[model samples]
Target: MSERKQRADATRNREAVLAAADALFARSESPRSVSMDEIAAAAGVGKGTLFRRFGDRTGLIQALYEARVQPLREAVESGPAPLGPSTPPLERVPALLDAMLRFKMDNRHLSMALEEAGSGSPYAAGHYTRWHSDLEEMLRQIPATATTAGFTAHALLAATRADLVEHLLGEQQMTPEQVRQGLAGHIARVLGDHGND
Candidate 1:
């Protein structure tokens, strides 16, 4: 095959694998139980192809998670108010947290898988670093949080962690709206009333 054809085939295979993995994770009772072999079979690709393209299970999960969050990343990077760069810090901080919480809630399985992957430390992930950096910068813009922006960012993000969300939704039996309200209230306290703005 020509180089262009080879590249096209590779891209298609990658998309198929990601899509299959996504479906498996979505339906799985536990994301960790969804094996690479299953994904390969579902994608109609060889196991060797999966290993070659993604390196390992963690890598495959990371790619799928990144692909899933790409739209949110774009919105936060350059979209409209609340999530975009132009939003005020006070408004933006809570907005960002809420968005993240919703995302974790929506993609609980995949989010949990990614968080639990590789060294079992979400902090070790590139996505975690990016979120922390963005949140820290936003917190720094506000006078109340400027001094402890880093810690504050981490604290805020902890509320949106996948495990915590799972616990709240599954164990605590809190409704999604209840969780959102709780987070809004917590953020309000943390940011002194303007957090809900």
Candidate 2:
């Protein structure tokens, strides 16, 4: 009974830590700014407890990322609709890009972290590979993407990355309409030029 109680308490503490981590990840521009002390305070645990549980700040951040963002990745790949199926590769190509971009725009802190990691982080690479493969499969259907879905997949990456959108909007001050047109034009040129259908 004592062990059971201890286990329950630990579970509660872990959940609290994850919740704080999630909030911090959303609010912070960099994972470095979010400290173990803050997470401990937010989780209602001692700093020592946080260290013991997570081993280090990066470990906690990584766990928080896995807990929070992995689901979004899975949903995009396997969940449903525009992302899952029920739509052709051409339609899905843009829709998936748009959805991912929106998710990143909405979750900037997490976005920043992942962007920083890029291909360095295994989890980040895995997610991108899935997106690239999915896009390639779709690109296979279109003539432009037809010859080499891999090339088209790379093009889609260029068109949809959040950093690029932020650059176009925040720095260049391009209107939403301009951004939309640019993305569409990019997709069209890529697909229309070699597009079979």
What are the lDDT figures for the candidates, one per model?
0.91, 0.72
Instruction: Give the per-residue lDDT digits (tens) of candidate 1, residues 1-197.
Output: 89999999999999999999999998998988999999999999999999999999999999988988998999899999989999999899889999999999889989999888887667867999999999999999997788888998898998898999999999999999999999998988888833334
> Estimated TM-score per prediction?
0.94, 0.73
- The backbone clash count of each candidate, in order, is 0, 4
Candidate 2 lDDT by residue in tens digits, 7-115: 9998899889988877876777565577778889988899998988888776675566567667666766677776776677777877777776666556556655555
**Per-candidate alpha-carbon RMSD to the true structure:** 2.4, 3.7
Model 2's alpha-carbon lDDT is 0.72
Q: Tell me the lDDT of model 2 at 171.
A: 86
Give the number of the best model, judged by TM-score.
Answer: 1
TM-score of 2: 0.73
